[model samples]
Target chain A: MRTKRTNWLATCFLIAGSVFLLFPLYMTFMLSIKDNKEIADSVLAFPKVWRWENFITAAEKVNYWQKFKNSSIITVLTVTFTLFTNSFVAYAIKKKFDHKFFKGLYFYFISAMFVPFPIIMLPVVKLTARLGLDNLYGLILLYIVYGLSFNVLLYVGYLRSLPQELDEAAIVDGASVWQTFWKIIFPLLAPINATVAIITTVWAWNDFLLPLIMLDQESQTTLPLAQFIFQSKFGQDTNLAFASYLMAMAPLLIVYILAQKWIISGVTRGAVK
Target chain B: MKKNNFGIYLLLVLPATILFFIFHTIPAVMGIFYSFTDWNGLKPTYKMVGFINYLNVFKDKDVLDAYLFTFKFAILTTVIVNVVSLCIALALNSNIKLKNFFKGLYFMPYILSMLIVAYIFNYFFANFWIDIMGYLGIEKWMVNPLGNEKGAWLAIVFVTVWQSAAFNTVLYLAGLQTISEDLYEASALDGANKWKEFWGITFPMIAPFFTINMVLSLKGFLQVFDQVLALTGGGPFGVTRSIALLIYKNGFSGNEFAYQSANAVIYFVVIVAISLIQLRYLQKREMNL
Candidate 1:
């Protein structure tokens, strides 16, 4: 009976906690639907009227398609470059036990994770301008390099745990090293690659700074930058701003909710392994 | 075959290595190097102005405040994220019916772009929850969590805790799973109470996980930018300026490239020092398993 009481208490605590966590997101949906006057007056009140046009207005104001295109290009480019480099680097490091150079390379890459981005944010922008990489291509290049370590570590761990039987089997069948990796090892890498792609996509899609620095030209700004513009332009119109924000997030929220399971598995597996 | 394998390794690493050298390593090295100079980040002419930049960094009371605030913010977020993560993990780890579904829901924030999460909270903070509080008949406080000083910190912490707790909970869940079920059986057999079982068996088994999650949260929190930008914008007279946001302003907006680099260097050092200490401490406690 005592245990039952404590268990009930625990269940309540857990439920309350989850609800509390969900509250912020729940309120966001509510605020987005309310008009501005109602916002200040009814801070927590139910919407007197759901102005569905707000979303339509937001979509038009932000030129939603172009921003989406920009973000898509950036995300695709980043994920490709990041995965390629991360896998390549991990392959090199995985070959290390007998090779001192490989060991040094591994350490070099691992140490990169320690340096915070704020330190280099200034100088890197300068260098980008100097190097003429201060454009779409430049932004892509920058993310690939800076974001390599964590992804590389992820690949290295997964690769390290891979069995040698596959390699030996391929070799016995007279497959070349390149062939062995591409035709054999790379296929086995699909799951980790998906994980890497998903993680990088989330990071790239949300990235505001690198593009903010590199893509100063109006035509070049990605979705987040465009969202920034929409935000400031419509700042005084809270209802409009909320609408824009909601529109901006709609696709991302959908994609995430859909992929949340695959992502969780990948993240936990990546981290714990 | 062996010689060809070495050549292949070289081939694979080259493209990434070149990019890594250009974008990450050199810039970081130059970030530290240029902090001592008087470069505006654009003009051709520059001079190595020793100690002046660092002196200016220290002299700027705003930067100092940002430092203290960022440190407190990172430390607080890391601690809270871990604690809340542990709690959610324990809850989820229990025999719940809708465990995976709830885990999925909780982790939704972590997967959503920070931009989206920030926007969601930006609205949640200013408008809706307050209304819910009213409906529940406890709307007296009506404080906008993201508005004022205390409230801003609270809001940021709350948002961060909420969003990140799920991520860490997954980590803990994975860790919890890895803890030999036998350990619990052993504890139960020994008449160890639940709390004692947790303290002894559960906590220690997830040693490496603790270290990894701690480091991940530290690095993640230390680089906070989006929430501050979206939610507070360092408003109410600049109280919410994180070190990352501070660096962004100084670098991109403030036109003090060299000075901003100094700020970043200082930020980097603080992060590395803290991480190194935490890693070492965790490593010391971790068992051979």
Candidate 2:
């Protein structure tokens, strides 16, 4: 009887928590479809009109496709480069963990995990501008570089758990180190790669500050940057702002819903490590 | 054979190393170097001021207020998030129906952009919250929280906790799964009450995770930016201005590049110190347990 009561209590608590957690998202969806007069009538009311044109109008106003393209390019390139470069470096460090140089390199990469981004923000901006890297590609390059510490940590830790014998066997089969890693080792890293990719995708897709600082041109803006500037410029249009927000977040929300389990487990796995 | 191995190692690592060096290492070094100088970020030449900027960081009221606000925000969010998430984790770890569904629903907010989340909540505070409060006859909350100095910081904390607690709950859930069910059963058999069981069994088991959540949350919150930027823009008399936002504003807009770099360096030191202290204390407690 006690166990049943407790279970009932837990369920109630969880439902309430979920409502609170999701209220803003619910409101966003509701407001996105409501005109300003309807919004002023009742903030909580379901829209009688269901104005889907809010989304169309928002997309056109923000040049949604262009920003979407920029975001996709940056996120895709950043995730891809991060996976290859960080894993390649981790593999080398794992293979040569016995060497002082490699061990020092490992520590060098890991130490960066402690440094906050703001500390390096100004100088990095200065350097990037000086190097003519103040653009989307530069932002992608920075993500790949900044990702080294955490991604390398994850990869090296996972790599250590896999036996060295696999690499040796591949090498014995006339495979070069590169071939051995790509063929035998990299494939074995599917789980960690998923975790890395999920984490990187969420970060790169949602990040606003890096793009805000790097990409000065209006045409170079990512979805988040564009939405930010849009809201500030069109501060009075709550309905349109919410519509733009909904559209901006729609891709990530769809992806999350589709791969809910993978994302949850991936995030959990990343954190617990 | 050794020479060949060295070549392979270079081949694999040097590209990443060069990128890390150029972007990460050089910038960090430059940040430190410039923190001591009077460089305004535009001029090519400036004299090294030898810790003058760091000295000004202590004397400057805005910088000091930013540190205080940031620390307060970090501490409040860290405690609230950890406690709330731990409770949610405990409830989820109990015998509940639709556990996976609830878990997925709760974790949804975390994947959304912080800027977007902040914007959504900005509207909530400005409109929905006021309406709800008016309906409830709560005159205090009838006005927009983001426009009040005290309410603005609390609102930021509330929103941060809302999104961040989900992630921590997931962490705590992972920790909860590691415990043997037999231990709980044994504790129950010993006539331990729920509170006793939690303190005696669950808390200790999840202490390591408690440490991880606390440290990570504190470190992240100490550098709070996007929420403040999107919601308050460090307004209501700049009471909600975080060190990170202050650094950005001062460095970029205010053109106090060298001074903000110094502040940034100090902020970096504070984060490292706090994290180290938390880890040491928490890990020690874990060991004692």
Q: Which candidate comes out best when scored by lDDT?
A: 2
Of candidate 1 chain B, the 10-residue stretch with the lowest lDDT total is: B1-10
| Model 1 DockQ vs. reference | 0.50
Each prediction's Cα lDDT score?
0.77, 0.89
Model 1, A157-235: lDDT tens digits are 8988888677767766787766777787888888888888877887788788778777867777777778777777777
* Model 2 docking category: medium
Candidate 2, residues B114-139: lDDT per residue as tens digits?
A: 99999988888886778789899999
Can you write out model 2's per-residue Cα lDDT over A1-273, one digit (the tens) per residue? 135444988999999988897778788888889999999887678888999999999899999999999999999999998888788889999888888889999999988888998988999988899899999999999998888888988998888888778888767678888898889988999889999999899899999889988888999999999998998788788889899999999998999999999888987777666
Best by DockQ: 2
Best by TM-score: 2
- Provide backbone clash counts, one per model: 3, 0
Positional deviation of B56 in candidate 2, in angstroms? Answer: 1.3
